[model samples]
Target: MSLSHALLGLLIVEPRSGYELTKAFEADIGRYAWQAGHTSIYPELGKLAEAGLIEVTHEGARGSRTYAATDAGRDELRTWLLRRPQQSKVRNEDVLRMFLISALEPADAITMLRGIAQHTAAGAAELRQIRELNGPATQRGPAGFGLLAAEFGLRQFDAIHGWAQWAIEQLEATADGSQDGAAARSVG
Candidate 1:
Protein backbone atom coordinates (compact mmCIF):
# COMPACT_ATOMS: atom_id res chain seq x y z
CA MET A 1 0.00 0.00 0.00
CA SER A 2 1.05 3.59 -0.49
CA LEU A 3 2.55 5.45 2.47
CA SER A 4 -0.36 7.91 2.35
CA HIS A 5 -2.90 5.17 2.94
CA ALA A 6 -0.78 3.67 5.68
CA LEU A 7 -0.54 7.01 7.44
CA LEU A 8 -4.28 7.53 7.20
CA GLY A 9 -4.98 4.06 8.61
CA LEU A 10 -2.65 4.63 11.55
CA LEU A 11 -4.18 8.01 12.26
CA ILE A 12 -7.59 6.42 12.41
CA VAL A 13 -6.40 4.39 15.37
CA GLU A 14 -5.41 7.42 17.45
CA PRO A 15 -3.79 10.76 17.36
CA ARG A 16 0.00 10.58 17.33
CA SER A 17 2.99 12.81 16.87
CA GLY A 18 5.10 12.34 13.77
CA TYR A 19 7.73 10.61 15.89
CA GLU A 20 5.15 8.22 17.25
CA LEU A 21 3.90 7.48 13.76
CA THR A 22 7.42 6.79 12.64
CA LYS A 23 7.92 4.48 15.60
CA ALA A 24 4.74 2.59 14.78
CA PHE A 25 5.99 1.87 11.29
CA GLU A 26 9.46 0.95 12.52
CA ALA A 27 8.20 -1.40 15.18
CA ASP A 28 5.12 -2.75 13.46
CA ILE A 29 4.16 -2.97 9.79
CA GLY A 30 7.40 -1.49 8.54
CA ARG A 31 9.31 -4.49 9.79
CA TYR A 32 7.51 -6.95 7.54
CA ALA A 33 5.22 -5.11 5.14
CA TRP A 34 6.45 -1.67 4.09
CA GLN A 35 9.48 0.40 5.01
CA ALA A 36 9.45 4.13 5.69
CA GLY A 37 11.67 6.52 7.54
CA HIS A 38 10.96 9.64 9.56
CA THR A 39 12.12 11.82 6.71
CA SER A 40 9.59 10.27 4.34
CA ILE A 41 6.77 10.11 6.90
CA TYR A 42 6.93 13.77 7.98
CA PRO A 43 6.46 15.01 4.43
CA GLU A 44 3.60 12.61 3.81
CA LEU A 45 1.97 13.82 7.02
CA GLY A 46 2.16 17.36 5.70
CA LYS A 47 0.68 16.32 2.38
CA LEU A 48 -2.17 14.56 4.16
CA ALA A 49 -2.81 17.72 6.14
CA GLU A 50 -2.76 19.86 3.02
CA ALA A 51 -5.21 17.53 1.29
CA GLY A 52 -7.57 17.68 4.29
CA LEU A 53 -7.13 13.97 4.87
CA ILE A 54 -5.56 14.44 8.29
CA GLU A 55 -5.39 17.28 10.80
CA VAL A 56 -3.18 18.30 13.62
CA THR A 57 -4.79 17.20 16.83
CA HIS A 58 -2.23 18.57 19.26
CA GLU A 59 1.15 20.16 19.38
CA GLY A 60 3.84 18.91 21.73
CA ALA A 61 7.18 20.32 22.80
CA ARG A 62 9.72 21.29 20.14
CA GLY A 63 6.99 21.74 17.52
CA SER A 64 5.98 18.13 17.64
CA ARG A 65 2.53 17.93 16.06
CA THR A 66 0.08 15.13 16.75
CA TYR A 67 -2.29 14.25 13.95
CA ALA A 68 -5.53 12.38 13.53
CA ALA A 69 -7.43 11.30 10.46
CA THR A 70 -10.15 13.64 9.27
CA ASP A 71 -13.52 12.33 8.20
CA ALA A 72 -12.44 12.75 4.63
CA GLY A 73 -9.29 10.78 5.36
CA ARG A 74 -11.26 7.97 6.90
CA ASP A 75 -13.51 7.85 3.85
CA GLU A 76 -10.52 7.81 1.57
CA LEU A 77 -8.81 5.06 3.52
CA ARG A 78 -11.97 2.98 3.62
CA THR A 79 -12.45 3.29 -0.11
CA TRP A 80 -8.88 2.30 -0.81
CA LEU A 81 -9.08 -0.61 1.60
CA LEU A 82 -12.19 -2.00 -0.05
CA ARG A 83 -10.79 -1.84 -3.56
CA ARG A 84 -8.61 -4.65 -4.94
CA PRO A 85 -5.02 -3.59 -4.84
CA GLN A 86 -2.87 -3.72 -7.96
CA GLN A 87 -0.62 -6.77 -8.04
CA SER A 88 2.61 -5.79 -6.38
CA LYS A 89 5.87 -6.25 -8.23
CA VAL A 90 8.22 -8.32 -6.16
CA ARG A 91 11.62 -6.74 -5.50
CA ASN A 92 13.38 -8.75 -2.83
CA GLU A 93 17.13 -8.29 -3.19
CA ASP A 94 17.94 -11.44 -1.23
CA VAL A 95 15.77 -13.62 -3.45
CA LEU A 96 17.20 -11.96 -6.53
CA ARG A 97 20.68 -12.76 -5.27
CA MET A 98 19.60 -16.36 -4.89
CA PHE A 99 19.14 -16.41 -8.66
CA LEU A 100 22.80 -15.58 -9.04
CA ILE A 101 24.05 -18.25 -6.64
CA SER A 102 25.06 -20.57 -9.46
CA ALA A 103 27.55 -17.95 -10.58
CA LEU A 104 29.53 -18.62 -7.43
CA GLU A 105 31.52 -21.72 -6.60
CA PRO A 106 29.58 -24.34 -4.67
CA ALA A 107 31.45 -23.58 -1.45
CA ASP A 108 30.61 -19.90 -1.75
CA ALA A 109 27.02 -20.68 -2.64
CA ILE A 110 26.79 -22.89 0.40
CA THR A 111 28.11 -20.06 2.55
CA MET A 112 25.61 -17.63 1.10
CA LEU A 113 22.68 -19.96 1.64
CA ARG A 114 23.78 -20.63 5.21
CA GLY A 115 23.79 -16.89 5.81
CA ILE A 116 20.25 -16.67 4.48
CA ALA A 117 19.16 -19.43 6.82
CA GLN A 118 20.67 -17.59 9.75
CA HIS A 119 19.06 -14.33 8.78
CA THR A 120 15.63 -15.87 8.30
CA ALA A 121 15.89 -17.66 11.61
CA ALA A 122 16.79 -14.40 13.35
CA GLY A 123 13.84 -12.62 11.72
CA ALA A 124 11.46 -15.36 12.80
CA ALA A 125 12.73 -15.11 16.37
CA GLU A 126 12.27 -11.35 16.42
CA LEU A 127 8.72 -11.63 15.10
CA ARG A 128 7.94 -14.26 17.67
CA GLN A 129 9.19 -11.97 20.41
CA ILE A 130 7.03 -9.16 19.11
CA ARG A 131 3.98 -11.39 19.07
CA GLU A 132 4.64 -12.57 22.57
CA LEU A 133 4.99 -9.01 23.80
CA ASN A 134 2.05 -7.45 21.96
CA GLY A 135 -0.26 -10.11 20.63
CA PRO A 136 -2.57 -10.54 23.59
CA ALA A 137 -3.29 -6.87 24.11
CA THR A 138 -3.63 -6.13 20.42
CA GLN A 139 -5.79 -9.14 19.61
CA ARG A 140 -8.56 -8.01 21.91
CA GLY A 141 -9.04 -4.52 20.58
CA PRO A 142 -9.93 -2.78 17.33
CA ALA A 143 -6.28 -3.38 16.53
CA GLY A 144 -6.88 -7.12 16.35
CA PHE A 145 -6.61 -7.09 12.56
CA GLY A 146 -2.92 -6.48 13.06
CA LEU A 147 -2.59 -9.91 14.63
CA LEU A 148 -3.67 -11.59 11.43
CA ALA A 149 -1.05 -9.75 9.37
CA ALA A 150 1.59 -10.42 11.97
CA GLU A 151 0.76 -14.13 11.94
CA PHE A 152 1.14 -14.20 8.18
CA GLY A 153 4.54 -12.58 8.44
CA LEU A 154 5.62 -15.04 11.12
CA ARG A 155 4.51 -17.97 8.99
CA GLN A 156 6.32 -16.63 5.94
CA PHE A 157 9.52 -16.37 7.91
CA ASP A 158 9.04 -19.86 9.28
CA ALA A 159 8.61 -21.31 5.81
CA ILE A 160 11.59 -19.46 4.41
CA HIS A 161 13.79 -20.44 7.32
CA GLY A 162 12.81 -24.08 6.97
CA TRP A 163 13.58 -24.08 3.27
CA ALA A 164 16.87 -22.36 3.83
CA GLN A 165 17.92 -24.92 6.40
CA TRP A 166 16.96 -27.76 4.08
CA ALA A 167 18.90 -26.20 1.23
CA ILE A 168 21.95 -25.84 3.40
CA GLU A 169 21.81 -29.48 4.34
CA GLN A 170 21.48 -30.47 0.71
CA LEU A 171 24.49 -28.37 -0.13
CA GLU A 172 26.51 -29.91 2.66
CA ALA A 173 25.64 -33.38 1.44
CA THR A 174 26.70 -32.40 -2.04
CA ALA A 175 29.92 -30.92 -0.69
CA ASP A 176 30.77 -34.22 0.97
CA GLY A 177 29.99 -35.99 -2.36
CA SER A 178 27.49 -38.14 -0.50
CA GLN A 179 24.43 -37.18 -2.57
CA ASP A 180 25.84 -37.53 -6.06
CA GLY A 181 24.26 -34.26 -7.29
CA ALA A 182 21.07 -34.67 -5.34
CA ALA A 183 20.60 -30.90 -5.27
CA ALA A 184 20.78 -30.64 -9.05
CA ARG A 185 18.52 -33.64 -9.54
CA SER A 186 15.94 -32.22 -7.12
CA VAL A 187 15.74 -29.01 -9.10
CA GLY A 188 15.44 -30.86 -12.41
Candidate 2:
Protein backbone atom coordinates (compact mmCIF):
# COMPACT_ATOMS: atom_id res chain seq x y z
CA MET A 1 0.00 0.00 0.00
CA SER A 2 1.19 3.53 -0.79
CA LEU A 3 1.19 5.52 2.43
CA SER A 4 1.50 8.77 0.53
CA HIS A 5 -1.68 8.09 -1.43
CA ALA A 6 -3.55 6.96 1.65
CA LEU A 7 -2.52 10.07 3.56
CA LEU A 8 -3.37 12.26 0.62
CA GLY A 9 -6.84 10.69 0.34
CA LEU A 10 -7.53 11.45 4.00
CA LEU A 11 -6.18 14.98 3.71
CA ILE A 12 -8.39 15.62 0.72
CA VAL A 13 -11.42 14.96 2.89
CA GLU A 14 -10.27 17.33 5.65
CA PRO A 15 -7.21 18.99 7.13
CA ARG A 16 -5.60 17.01 9.95
CA SER A 17 -2.45 16.86 11.99
CA GLY A 18 -0.04 14.00 11.59
CA TYR A 19 -1.14 12.44 14.89
CA GLU A 20 -4.78 12.46 13.85
CA LEU A 21 -3.95 10.91 10.47
CA THR A 22 -1.95 8.12 12.14
CA LYS A 23 -4.76 7.32 14.54
CA ALA A 24 -7.42 7.35 11.84
CA PHE A 25 -5.30 5.24 9.51
CA GLU A 26 -4.80 2.66 12.27
CA ALA A 27 -8.47 2.61 13.20
CA ASP A 28 -9.77 2.25 9.65
CA ILE A 29 -7.52 1.15 6.77
CA GLY A 30 -4.59 -0.18 8.77
CA ARG A 31 -6.64 -3.16 9.87
CA TYR A 32 -6.62 -4.40 6.29
CA ALA A 33 -3.35 -2.85 5.03
CA TRP A 34 0.04 -1.96 6.47
CA GLN A 35 0.46 1.56 7.80
CA ALA A 36 3.38 3.97 7.68
CA GLY A 37 5.37 4.88 10.77
CA HIS A 38 6.57 8.34 11.84
CA THR A 39 9.97 7.95 10.15
CA SER A 40 8.34 7.30 6.77
CA ILE A 41 5.30 9.54 7.16
CA TYR A 42 7.16 12.70 8.17
CA PRO A 43 9.54 12.49 5.22
CA GLU A 44 6.67 11.87 2.80
CA LEU A 45 4.79 14.80 4.27
CA GLY A 46 7.85 17.03 3.84
CA LYS A 47 8.21 15.94 0.22
CA LEU A 48 4.51 16.53 -0.46
CA ALA A 49 4.67 19.96 1.16
CA GLU A 50 7.73 20.88 -0.91
CA ALA A 51 6.00 19.80 -4.09
CA GLY A 52 2.97 22.02 -3.28
CA LEU A 53 0.71 18.96 -3.10
CA ILE A 54 -0.23 19.77 0.49
CA GLU A 55 -0.34 22.96 2.56
CA VAL A 56 0.63 22.99 6.21
CA THR A 57 -0.64 25.36 8.89
CA HIS A 58 0.93 25.51 12.30
CA GLU A 59 -1.36 25.61 15.32
CA GLY A 60 -0.30 27.45 18.45
CA ALA A 61 0.24 25.86 21.87
CA ARG A 62 0.03 22.30 20.53
CA GLY A 63 2.76 23.11 17.95
CA SER A 64 1.06 20.66 15.66
CA ARG A 65 1.12 21.20 11.94
CA THR A 66 -2.17 20.48 10.23
CA TYR A 67 -2.08 19.48 6.56
CA ALA A 68 -4.70 19.92 3.88
CA ALA A 69 -4.60 18.82 0.27
CA THR A 70 -4.11 21.55 -2.31
CA ASP A 71 -6.20 21.84 -5.47
CA ALA A 72 -3.35 20.33 -7.45
CA GLY A 73 -2.99 17.61 -4.89
CA ARG A 74 -6.66 16.74 -5.13
CA ASP A 75 -6.41 16.56 -8.89
CA GLU A 76 -3.35 14.36 -8.66
CA LEU A 77 -4.97 12.07 -6.14
CA ARG A 78 -8.10 11.75 -8.30
CA THR A 79 -6.01 10.88 -11.30
CA TRP A 80 -4.09 8.29 -9.30
CA LEU A 81 -7.26 6.65 -8.01
CA LEU A 82 -8.73 6.48 -11.49
CA ARG A 83 -5.64 5.00 -13.09
CA ARG A 84 -5.04 1.24 -13.05
CA PRO A 85 -2.41 0.19 -10.56
CA GLN A 86 0.54 -1.92 -11.65
CA GLN A 87 0.50 -5.54 -10.56
CA SER A 88 3.09 -6.47 -7.96
CA LYS A 89 5.05 -9.72 -7.94
CA VAL A 90 3.83 -12.31 -5.46
CA ARG A 91 6.61 -13.71 -3.25
CA ASN A 92 5.38 -16.35 -0.83
CA GLU A 93 8.16 -17.64 1.38
CA ASP A 94 6.02 -20.45 2.81
CA VAL A 95 5.52 -22.03 -0.63
CA LEU A 96 9.23 -21.67 -1.44
CA ARG A 97 10.25 -23.30 1.85
CA MET A 98 7.76 -26.12 1.35
CA PHE A 99 9.16 -26.80 -2.14
CA LEU A 100 12.61 -27.29 -0.58
CA ILE A 101 11.43 -29.45 2.35
CA SER A 102 12.72 -32.67 0.74
CA ALA A 103 16.17 -31.57 1.97
CA LEU A 104 14.93 -32.16 5.55
CA GLU A 105 13.72 -35.34 7.24
CA PRO A 106 10.04 -36.19 7.00
CA ALA A 107 9.61 -35.47 10.73
CA ASP A 108 11.01 -31.98 10.26
CA ALA A 109 8.72 -31.42 7.28
CA ILE A 110 5.72 -32.46 9.37
CA THR A 111 6.75 -30.00 12.07
CA MET A 112 6.98 -27.22 9.51
CA LEU A 113 3.55 -28.15 8.16
CA ARG A 114 2.08 -27.96 11.67
CA GLY A 115 3.55 -24.50 12.13
CA ILE A 116 2.14 -23.37 8.78
CA ALA A 117 -1.30 -24.65 9.73
CA GLN A 118 -1.21 -22.65 12.96
CA HIS A 119 -0.16 -19.49 11.12
CA THR A 120 -2.84 -19.94 8.47
CA ALA A 121 -5.53 -20.45 11.11
CA ALA A 122 -4.48 -17.20 12.79
CA GLY A 123 -4.53 -15.36 9.46
CA ALA A 124 -8.04 -16.65 8.73
CA ALA A 125 -9.22 -15.32 12.09
CA GLU A 126 -7.80 -11.89 11.32
CA LEU A 127 -9.49 -11.83 7.92
CA ARG A 128 -12.77 -12.80 9.54
CA GLN A 129 -12.47 -9.83 11.86
CA ILE A 130 -11.79 -7.56 8.93
CA ARG A 131 -14.87 -8.88 7.17
CA GLU A 132 -17.02 -8.25 10.24
CA LEU A 133 -15.70 -4.72 10.63
CA ASN A 134 -16.29 -3.91 6.99
CA GLY A 135 -19.84 -5.34 7.15
CA PRO A 136 -22.31 -4.02 4.58
CA ALA A 137 -19.82 -1.55 3.19
CA THR A 138 -18.31 -4.45 1.29
CA GLN A 139 -21.66 -5.67 -0.10
CA ARG A 140 -22.83 -2.49 -1.71
CA GLY A 141 -22.95 -3.74 -5.30
CA PRO A 142 -20.24 -2.46 -7.65
CA ALA A 143 -18.75 -0.14 -5.08
CA GLY A 144 -17.88 -3.05 -2.77
CA PHE A 145 -14.29 -3.56 -3.88
CA GLY A 146 -13.15 -3.66 -0.26
CA LEU A 147 -15.57 -6.50 0.38
CA LEU A 148 -14.09 -8.36 -2.56
CA ALA A 149 -10.63 -7.88 -1.13
CA ALA A 150 -11.68 -9.19 2.28
CA GLU A 151 -13.28 -12.23 0.65
CA PHE A 152 -10.10 -12.87 -1.31
CA GLY A 153 -8.10 -12.78 1.95
CA LEU A 154 -10.51 -15.27 3.52
CA ARG A 155 -10.18 -17.70 0.60
CA GLN A 156 -6.39 -17.39 0.47
CA PHE A 157 -6.10 -18.20 4.16
CA ASP A 158 -8.46 -21.11 3.80
CA ALA A 159 -6.37 -22.52 0.94
CA ILE A 160 -3.21 -22.14 2.98
CA HIS A 161 -4.78 -23.98 5.91
CA GLY A 162 -5.93 -26.84 3.65
CA TRP A 163 -2.52 -27.07 2.00
CA ALA A 164 -0.82 -27.24 5.38
CA GLN A 165 -3.04 -30.09 6.52
CA TRP A 166 -2.44 -32.00 3.29
CA ALA A 167 1.31 -31.45 3.63
CA ILE A 168 1.26 -32.84 7.18
CA GLU A 169 -0.47 -36.00 5.98
CA GLN A 170 1.95 -36.44 3.09
CA LEU A 171 4.98 -35.96 5.34
CA GLU A 172 3.62 -38.40 7.93
CA ALA A 173 3.00 -40.99 5.21
CA THR A 174 6.56 -40.58 3.92
CA ALA A 175 7.97 -40.90 7.44
CA ASP A 176 5.98 -44.08 8.17
CA GLY A 177 6.50 -45.57 4.70
CA SER A 178 2.74 -46.10 4.55
CA GLN A 179 2.49 -45.08 0.90
CA ASP A 180 4.96 -47.75 -0.25
CA GLY A 181 3.49 -50.53 1.96
CA ALA A 182 6.88 -51.09 3.52
CA ALA A 183 8.59 -50.66 6.91
CA ALA A 184 8.91 -47.17 8.40
CA ARG A 185 11.94 -45.17 7.28
CA SER A 186 14.31 -44.27 10.11
CA VAL A 187 15.66 -40.74 10.01
CA GLY A 188 19.45 -41.02 10.43
Candidate 3:
Protein backbone atom coordinates (compact mmCIF):
# COMPACT_ATOMS: atom_id res chain seq x y z
CA MET A 1 0.00 0.00 0.00
CA SER A 2 1.13 3.56 -0.71
CA LEU A 3 1.64 5.33 2.60
CA SER A 4 1.39 8.74 0.93
CA HIS A 5 -1.93 7.96 -0.70
CA ALA A 6 -3.25 6.40 2.50
CA LEU A 7 -2.30 9.54 4.43
CA LEU A 8 -4.01 11.67 1.80
CA GLY A 9 -7.19 9.62 2.16
CA LEU A 10 -7.09 10.01 5.94
CA LEU A 11 -6.53 13.75 5.68
CA ILE A 12 -9.45 13.99 3.31
CA VAL A 13 -11.54 12.54 6.10
CA GLU A 14 -10.32 15.23 8.50
CA PRO A 15 -7.30 17.35 9.44
CA ARG A 16 -5.03 15.55 11.89
CA SER A 17 -1.72 15.97 13.63
CA GLY A 18 1.13 13.54 13.03
CA TYR A 19 0.31 11.82 16.30
CA GLU A 20 -3.34 11.50 15.35
CA LEU A 21 -2.42 10.00 12.02
CA THR A 22 -0.22 7.44 13.74
CA LYS A 23 -3.11 6.59 16.01
CA ALA A 24 -5.33 6.17 12.95
CA PHE A 25 -2.95 3.69 11.38
CA GLU A 26 -2.67 1.69 14.56
CA ALA A 27 -6.37 1.57 15.29
CA ASP A 28 -8.14 1.45 11.96
CA ILE A 29 -6.30 1.68 8.65
CA GLY A 30 -3.35 -0.51 9.64
CA ARG A 31 -5.66 -3.25 10.88
CA TYR A 32 -6.76 -4.20 7.37
CA ALA A 33 -5.05 -1.93 4.87
CA TRP A 34 -1.87 0.20 5.10
CA GLN A 35 0.54 0.43 8.01
CA ALA A 36 2.90 3.36 8.67
CA GLY A 37 4.85 4.21 11.76
CA HIS A 38 5.70 7.84 12.59
CA THR A 39 9.17 7.54 11.03
CA SER A 40 7.74 6.84 7.56
CA ILE A 41 4.63 8.97 8.08
CA TYR A 42 6.58 12.07 9.09
CA PRO A 43 8.84 11.95 6.04
CA GLU A 44 5.89 11.34 3.74
CA LEU A 45 4.10 14.29 5.33
CA GLY A 46 7.10 16.51 4.61
CA LYS A 47 7.18 15.35 1.01
CA LEU A 48 3.45 15.97 0.65
CA ALA A 49 4.02 19.48 2.01
CA GLU A 50 6.97 20.06 -0.34
CA ALA A 51 4.87 18.95 -3.30
CA GLY A 52 1.99 21.21 -2.27
CA LEU A 53 -0.32 18.23 -1.95
CA ILE A 54 -0.87 18.95 1.74
CA GLU A 55 -0.45 21.92 4.07
CA VAL A 56 -0.08 22.49 7.76
CA THR A 57 -3.39 23.85 9.02
CA HIS A 58 -2.61 24.24 12.69
CA GLU A 59 0.24 24.34 15.16
CA GLY A 60 -0.30 23.08 18.68
CA ALA A 61 1.77 22.78 21.85
CA ARG A 62 5.34 21.43 21.67
CA GLY A 63 5.63 22.26 17.96
CA SER A 64 2.94 19.76 16.97
CA ARG A 65 1.39 20.54 13.59
CA THR A 66 -1.97 19.48 12.15
CA TYR A 67 -2.21 18.91 8.39
CA ALA A 68 -4.94 18.84 5.80
CA ALA A 69 -4.92 17.74 2.20
CA THR A 70 -4.72 20.39 -0.49
CA ASP A 71 -7.02 20.43 -3.51
CA ALA A 72 -4.19 18.94 -5.51
CA GLY A 73 -3.94 16.12 -3.02
CA ARG A 74 -7.61 15.32 -3.48
CA ASP A 75 -7.18 15.28 -7.24
CA GLU A 76 -4.13 13.04 -6.93
CA LEU A 77 -5.90 10.68 -4.57
CA ARG A 78 -8.92 10.48 -6.87
CA THR A 79 -6.69 9.72 -9.83
CA TRP A 80 -4.87 7.02 -7.92
CA LEU A 81 -8.13 5.52 -6.77
CA LEU A 82 -9.40 5.38 -10.34
CA ARG A 83 -6.30 3.81 -11.81
CA ARG A 84 -6.18 0.09 -12.51
CA PRO A 85 -4.07 -1.72 -9.95
CA GLN A 86 -1.24 -3.83 -11.30
CA GLN A 87 -0.94 -7.48 -10.35
CA SER A 88 1.88 -8.04 -7.87
CA LYS A 89 3.64 -11.11 -6.50
CA VAL A 90 1.91 -12.47 -3.40
CA ARG A 91 4.13 -13.44 -0.44
CA ASN A 92 1.82 -14.88 2.17
CA GLU A 93 3.86 -16.94 4.67
CA ASP A 94 0.86 -18.89 5.95
CA VAL A 95 -0.01 -20.04 2.44
CA LEU A 96 3.59 -21.10 1.86
CA ARG A 97 3.57 -23.19 5.01
CA MET A 98 0.36 -24.90 3.99
CA PHE A 99 1.81 -25.71 0.56
CA LEU A 100 4.70 -27.49 2.28
CA ILE A 101 2.60 -29.33 4.84
CA SER A 102 3.77 -32.70 3.54
CA ALA A 103 7.19 -31.92 4.97
CA LEU A 104 5.83 -32.25 8.50
CA GLU A 105 4.77 -35.41 10.35
CA PRO A 106 1.03 -36.19 10.33
CA ALA A 107 0.55 -35.15 13.97
CA ASP A 108 2.42 -31.88 13.47
CA ALA A 109 0.45 -31.17 10.31
CA ILE A 110 -2.82 -31.79 12.13
CA THR A 111 -1.73 -29.39 14.89
CA MET A 112 -0.87 -26.69 12.38
CA LEU A 113 -4.18 -27.13 10.57
CA ARG A 114 -6.06 -26.82 13.85
CA GLY A 115 -4.11 -23.67 14.69
CA ILE A 116 -5.04 -22.13 11.34
CA ALA A 117 -8.73 -22.85 11.95
CA GLN A 118 -8.62 -21.20 15.38
CA HIS A 119 -6.70 -18.16 14.16
CA THR A 120 -8.97 -17.52 11.19
CA ALA A 121 -12.09 -17.86 13.35
CA ALA A 122 -10.68 -15.28 15.77
CA GLY A 123 -9.80 -12.92 12.91
CA ALA A 124 -13.31 -13.24 11.50
CA ALA A 125 -14.80 -12.41 14.89
CA GLU A 126 -12.64 -9.28 15.16
CA LEU A 127 -13.70 -8.13 11.70
CA ARG A 128 -17.31 -8.67 12.66
CA GLN A 129 -16.84 -6.27 15.58
CA ILE A 130 -15.28 -3.73 13.26
CA ARG A 131 -18.19 -4.12 10.90
CA GLU A 132 -20.68 -3.48 13.68
CA LEU A 133 -18.80 -0.41 14.89
CA ASN A 134 -18.43 1.07 11.39
CA GLY A 135 -22.14 0.69 10.62
CA PRO A 136 -23.53 0.88 7.06
CA ALA A 137 -21.43 0.54 3.90
CA THR A 138 -22.72 3.37 1.77
CA GLN A 139 -20.33 5.51 -0.31
CA ARG A 140 -21.75 8.81 0.90
CA GLY A 141 -19.69 9.18 4.08
CA PRO A 142 -16.21 8.78 5.56
CA ALA A 143 -17.08 5.47 7.18
CA GLY A 144 -18.38 3.96 3.93
CA PHE A 145 -15.07 2.58 2.60
CA GLY A 146 -14.13 1.33 6.05
CA LEU A 147 -17.25 -0.79 6.33
CA LEU A 148 -16.59 -2.24 2.91
CA ALA A 149 -13.02 -3.07 3.83
CA ALA A 150 -14.15 -4.74 7.01
CA GLU A 151 -16.61 -6.87 5.09
CA PHE A 152 -13.85 -7.96 2.75
CA GLY A 153 -11.68 -9.00 5.70
CA LEU A 154 -14.55 -10.91 7.24
CA ARG A 155 -15.11 -12.92 4.05
CA GLN A 156 -11.42 -13.74 3.76
CA PHE A 157 -11.27 -14.95 7.32
CA ASP A 158 -14.31 -17.18 6.90
CA ALA A 159 -12.94 -18.74 3.73
CA ILE A 160 -9.56 -19.53 5.29
CA HIS A 161 -11.21 -20.94 8.36
CA GLY A 162 -13.37 -23.23 6.28
CA TRP A 163 -10.38 -24.50 4.32
CA ALA A 164 -8.46 -25.24 7.50
CA GLN A 165 -11.32 -27.33 8.88
CA TRP A 166 -11.54 -29.32 5.66
CA ALA A 167 -7.79 -29.95 5.76
CA ILE A 168 -7.98 -31.24 9.31
CA GLU A 169 -10.71 -33.68 8.42
CA GLN A 170 -8.68 -35.00 5.48
CA LEU A 171 -5.64 -35.54 7.67
CA GLU A 172 -7.62 -37.38 10.33
CA ALA A 173 -9.22 -39.70 7.80
CA THR A 174 -5.81 -40.58 6.40
CA ALA A 175 -4.44 -41.24 9.86
CA ASP A 176 -7.33 -43.51 10.67
CA GLY A 177 -6.90 -45.49 7.47
CA SER A 178 -3.18 -45.93 8.14
CA GLN A 179 -3.85 -47.27 11.63
CA ASP A 180 -6.38 -49.81 10.30
CA GLY A 181 -3.87 -50.99 7.68
CA ALA A 182 -1.16 -51.38 10.32
CA ALA A 183 -3.42 -53.49 12.52
CA ALA A 184 -4.41 -55.75 9.62
CA ARG A 185 -0.74 -56.30 8.63
CA SER A 186 0.26 -57.27 12.18
CA VAL A 187 -2.56 -59.86 12.38
CA GLY A 188 -1.61 -61.36 8.98
Per TM-score, the best of the predicted structures is: 3
lDDT of each: 0.83, 0.76, 0.87
- Superposed by TM-score, candidate 3 places the C-alpha of residue 185 at a distance from the truth, in angstroms, of 28
Per-residue lDDT value at 51 in model 3: 98
lDDT of 1 by residue, 24-109 (tens): 88977787777899999999999999999999988888999999999999999999999987777887797888788779888888
> What is candidate 3's CA lDDT for residue 64?
100
Candidate numbers, best TM-score first, in rank order: 3, 1, 2
Cα deviation of 128 in candidate 1 (Å)? 1.7
Candidate 3, TM-score vs. the true structure? 0.84
Estimate TM-scores for all models. Answer: 0.78, 0.67, 0.84
* Predicted structure 1, TM vs. truth: 0.78
In model 2, what lDDT does residue 97 have? 92
Model 1, total clashes: 0
Give the Cα RMSD of candidate 3: 5.8
Q: 1-188, model 2: which lDDT tens digit per residue?
A: 47888878778767888887777657636775666667777788888899899999766457789999999899889999899877788677867897798898878878887888898899889878877866754354323435666777778889989988876766677676685532223321
Tell me model 3's lDDT, rounded to 2 decimals. Answer: 0.87
